[model samples]
Target: MPIDPQAARLLAMLGAARPTDWPGVSAAARRDGFAALMRMAGTPPAVASVSDVRIAGAAGPLPARLYAPRDGTAPGLVYFHGGGLVAGDLDTHDALCRALAAGSDCRVLSVGYRLAPEHPFPAAAEDAVAAAGDALGRAAEFGLDPARVAVGGDSAGGTLATLAAGALRTRVALQLLLCPALDAAPDTESRRLFARGHLLDAAMMARDLADCAPGALDLADPRLSPLRDPDLAGRPPALIHTAEFDPLRDEGALYAERLAAAGVPVRHRCHPGMIHHFYGLTGLVPAARAALADIAAELGARLAMG
Candidate 1:
């Protein structure tokens, strides 16, 4: 299927201003640039309330933002933003968090994990585990039931969410992944099919993998690539969302298959004619909005199961 019309237009617009040499720019500049672009694409949807707080991290206090619905004491979701583990922060994903909180009627805690090249591999993963633990540990203070908490994110953040889920196991009710880059090895057919023209190209992904795992760290390590984990039997139920036109599409599908094979409940959906990062484009694309609503419904249902 061809890309959705609105999505195609977005791709064209992004291509027109896309950076030619990402490695040449400083990480801070790239972070700022990405945030500005997201802001220009659409205005954030309003929520009942948003507050900033710090959570205990492996390295230090991790800055986080909380989005609460109008009602009191709802389920909680620990969210991480996507930027290949190199860019993105709490501000970059503020709008998406607000939308999720409003749509799912759940409190969302968006964690600002340490980035790569500076903190390197396992640093972000460690911070993710710590933040999730903290969220569950302090669920009452956040007006959430500890047993109803879930962890989720998009792209690289999705990878982190999976790692956190594996580490926390049944403690987390569900795992929500959107266009997740689960495998460090890009040998899948989708990687070749959508390698260049799509918003996420092969070259950029390679750079991101290298930055996150500098030196001789094995890319196949389960901490670095959750799909490589030897055991997925005890992991939480999963709702995996993938894009038909995304390079990581096959891997996300494969991960779902693995989970199901390991006896874990899995709900996987591949959005036709969609590309990576479409979940955040809810304001500009009709498909994205629909997808967001579907995700919210699923999250709400699964969390309510307890």
Candidate 2:
């Protein structure tokens, strides 16, 4: 099927607005570029009644924004935003986080872990794991049910969410992955089919991997590439979403396959007419809103299960 008209328009808009020289810019410049992208893409930050707090991590403090639902303290999700692990923060994802909180009837903790290039490879990964630990460790303080905690993210954030699920090993109630770039190496059919003009270009992927990895990351390391994990045992249930026109689509689908093969209960969806980062385009994309609703329904059901 052809791409949705909205997706086509979005792609054209993105092409028109893309920076002329992003590949040669400083990390800070790259960060600013993504911030602008978020602004161009959707609604501004919602009134997050949720307070901001810093969690203790191995590398210092990891900042997080807490969004409590209208129902009060409930199950919660630790949501990481996608910016190639080099950009994006809580501010960029605040609207989506608030929507998730309201729709899922769960507290949403928007994690602001350190980005790469400056932090590099395992730094962001480690901080994510630590933040999950910190969240679980202080569940009572946050007024959340420890048994109902889940991990969720989009793109790079989704990859981290999955890694956190695997690392936590039953500590997380569920995993929500939205078009996650699970494999850094581009070897899948989706990577070939949707390599360009889908919001996530192959060149951008290469640039991000190069910046984030530097010399410390082995692309095949299971920590960096969850698809490389030989064992997916003991992980929690997961809901993984994929966009048909995303280079990362197959990796997300394949990871779901691997999870199911390992006996993890999984629900996977491939939106055939959508593109990468569609989940964050809820303001302008109808499919994006539906996707968010699906996630909210799933998370609400799972949270109620406990």
Candidate 3:
């Protein structure tokens, strides 16, 4: 299919906007812009309940939100938001988290991991691993079934989720990824075709990597790019969703292919006519709403107990 008409309009609106000053914008301002994008998601899908909670992070207490669509034990997910690893927070993804819990009848935990230009690369990665371990070890505290706790995220978060799941091996139930940026150095056709003017700015993406992984000589380190990780066997199953027009699409699909080759169960889907982070643009694109529902169905089927 061609680019979705609705998505095209959204792209137009974005194109008309004032450009951001990259490598100079403060992290706080970047986060504000990131949240503003999510505002277009319209009203978030309602869930049964929401709770503010804390999980042990690599450094200290990590503030988190738990969304439960039903009472009693259910499948759980630790979700990370998309912001290129330098921006985004719990509030930014609240609605999406609600929809996940409501749609899948799961307990969804949205992690507020540290951002870049401040906490930097290793910090977020460590927190992600710690949070997943903490959640898996104490699922009962969040009314979750320990055996079904999954780790997932969007964009940069998809990287975090993969790291956490890979670090813990088969203990994690699943790795649910949405437009994950898995390669620090990428040379894919998608990267060249959709490098800019598609919601995600490639130059800005370069800035994000510099901000988050400053001074890092090796980009292929699995901690920085999970796609480089060699030990895929015995890792939990994965469901990776990539947007057809996203620069990060090919890398994610490549990771899925690699995982399957390594004997890990994986499912990769490239949603046509969608851009990066399209799953969070429900208000701007009606097709995105359907995309979320489709993803939710996959989540429900994998976790079993929708």
Candidate 4:
């Protein structure tokens, strides 16, 4: 199938707006640019309520935002935003959180984990673990059901979520991964086929990985790349979402396969004609909206099973 017309238009618009010299810019500049680009994607749908709070992290007090569809206890999801673990913040993903909370009828705790280049690898991963612990411990205060809690994220955030799930296996209900970057050393055919022109290019991905892990850590380490984990039998059920035109597409699908093979129930969807980060562009693309709805429905159903 060909690329969706709406998605193709979005890609072209983004290409025209994005600076051609973005790759040569400093990390801080690139981060700001990326945030600005996301802000212009579309207007976020209104949710019941959104509040700011702080959660204890491994390093310090981590900033977080809670989005709820209504005022009451409900299933909760500890969500981490995507920016290659280098750029995104709570504000960057506020809209998506709102939509998820509204659509899924689940409270979403969006964590502001420490970014890379400043904190580095295992730092964000550690914070994810700490935040989930805090969220679970304080589930009552947040009006969440501890037994129905789930962990999720997109891109690098997805990597952190997977790590947290493995460490907190049997505790979490499900893992929702959207265009997750699971393989640190991705050598899939999709990576080669969509290496450039897509929203996330090969050069940008390499830079993000380097920034996150500046030290001499093995890329194949399961902590850095969950796909390398030899044992995934006890992890929670997973819902993996991929994009047809994404460089990370193959890896996300592969992770789903591995999870199912390991006896972990999995639901994987590869959206035809979509690209990386389309989850945040629901207002611009009908397909994106449909995908978000499906995610919300799945979350609601899975969490209700508790």
Candidate 5:
């Protein structure tokens, strides 16, 4: 599929903000730049209430935000934000969470997990698993139904979600992933086809891995690349979305196929002509708003069936 015109324009606009020496840019600088771009999410859709909260992490208190559309106990989601495992925070994805919580009728707990080059691999993953467990154990305090809880995220956060749900399969009600980087290094056609032009280029991804895992970390380890897991049986039901022009597209598709083959209930979609992170660019890609709504509706419907 050809790139969406809106997405193309967005890429063009972003091209100006990209550092000329991307490979040489420090992780701190990269994170700051990414934060600046995410600010374009603009004013978020209002939820009934929003507030800062602290949650249990693998090692300590994890900073987080709570977005609730109701005053009483409700379905809940433990969410992580995407920034290549080194960037992003609760505020960067505030708008997206508001929409999900309001539209999906779920209380969303947006987690600010530990980042790379500081805490490194397994740290964020461990925090993800812990946050989900903590949310479930203390659901009442967050005004959530302990029985109806999902784990989800976009991009790198999606990666964390996978690890968390896998570690807590029987407990998590659902898994929501958007344009997730499923593998550290996958040799899929999409990886080659869209390697250069998309917002998340290969070089950027490589840098993310370098900083994310650093020394002695095996990229092929299922802990880092869940797709490599030989068995997908009993994993939580999943709603996986990928972008047509994303380097990570094929890996998501393959995972969906494998999960189904393993008897796991799952649904996957590749947004035609869309690029990575398209769902979060609704302000620019108007059509992407409908995609997000579809997610909200699906999320609500699936959990209701529980």
Candidate 6:
């Protein structure tokens, strides 16, 4: 399949303006790099209402953003923002979450989970689990239906979503993963195919793993990498989206296969001519909105089932 022309152009422009060794750079520098990249993309503002509220967690109060659909009701989503678990927060991904809420018509709870190099491995994963539990416990307070809830995210957020679903089990209605960073192990077809030209590079990914699992956790551990998870049998249905030119694409695809093998319902799509960050290009890339519509349809169907 041909890559989306718009995505190709965007990648070319990004490569032309490449920053020096982003992974090895300072944490602040990497964060700034992402901000600059998004600014360049000129993403649409989040149409969903935004709130900076706190939820109770075993650790303490956790910050989160609630994106209510205009027509509000059941089928709420708990979203984790992508940033390799080292950067990005509710604010950084506000626009994407807003678009998701408006586009999918599902209330979105953007979890502001703790990051790494400061918090590290199980920290972000733990925060995500606690936040999901907190949301479910207070579903009525958020005007959401307790029976219809989905968990999702991109990149590192994708890992959190998968972990959250597995950790919460029957509590979630479905799982949505976009170019998930399911495995940090450097051996995958996507890595070989799009290692350089794709918006996300292997070097930066390596850096993310360093920062995210700096503590006593193993990067190859299935608990951290859904691809390696021994059993995905009872997990909720899933809608997994991958990009042709993404390094993490194979991991997502493999996870989908694993889920299916475990009898978990799964729908996986590999968008051609698209890159790792294409999911967030809802404004710039037509394929992005198309993908979102597919996701919205899936969410609607899941809500109907519940």
- Cα deviation at 115, candidate 1, in Å, is 0.8
TM-score: which is higher, 1 or 6?
1
Model 5 per-residue lDDT tens digits across residues 119-156:
88989999999998998888999998878899999999
Clashing pairs in 3: none
Tens digit per residue, CA lDDT, model 3, 1-306: 899999998889888873666768777777888889988878987787899999989999999999999889999899988898898899989888888888887889999998888888789999999998998888888998988889999999999998999888768888899999899888999999988788888888988899898884699889887888877788889999999999998999999999999998999999999999898899778999999988987897799842
Task: State in Å the error of residue 169, model 6.
Answer: 0.8
Q: Is candidate 1 or candidate 5 better by lDDT?
A: 5
**Backbone clash tally for model 5?**
0
TM-scores for all candidates: the values are: 0.96, 0.95, 0.97, 0.96, 0.97, 0.93
> 122-197, model 2: which lDDT tens digit per residue?
8888888888888999988886899999999999998889888988977899999989889877588889987777
- Per residue, candidate 4 scores C-alpha lDDT tens digits across 208-267 of 888889878899998789998999999999999999999999999999999999999999
RMSD of each: 1.3, 1.7, 1.3, 1.3, 1.1, 1.9
- Per-residue lDDT over 1-306 for candidate 6, one digit per residue giving the tens place of the 0 to 100 score: 788888888878878877657655877777777766654334654554666778655478888888876655657888888887877877777777777777677788888888878887778888888888899889988767888888999988999899889989899988989888888675887799877878888788778888877756776786577788888899999989888889888888889999999999999988777788776776688877677667666666776688
Candidate 5, residue 173: CA error in Å?
0.6
Q: How well is each residue in 1-306 modelled by candidate 1, as lDDT tens digits?
A: 889999999889888887768667677776776776556336666788899999879988999999988758888899988999998898888888888887888899999999988999889999999999999888998888788999999999999999889889879989999899898875899999988879998877877777888788888998778899999998999999999999999999999999999999999999998889888777788888888888888898889887
Quote the positional error of residue 119 for candidate 1 in Å: 1.0
Every candidate's lDDT: 0.87, 0.84, 0.88, 0.89, 0.88, 0.80
Give per-residue lDDT, candidate 1, residue 257: 99
lDDT of 2: 0.84
Model 4: how far is 234 from its true place, Å? 0.3
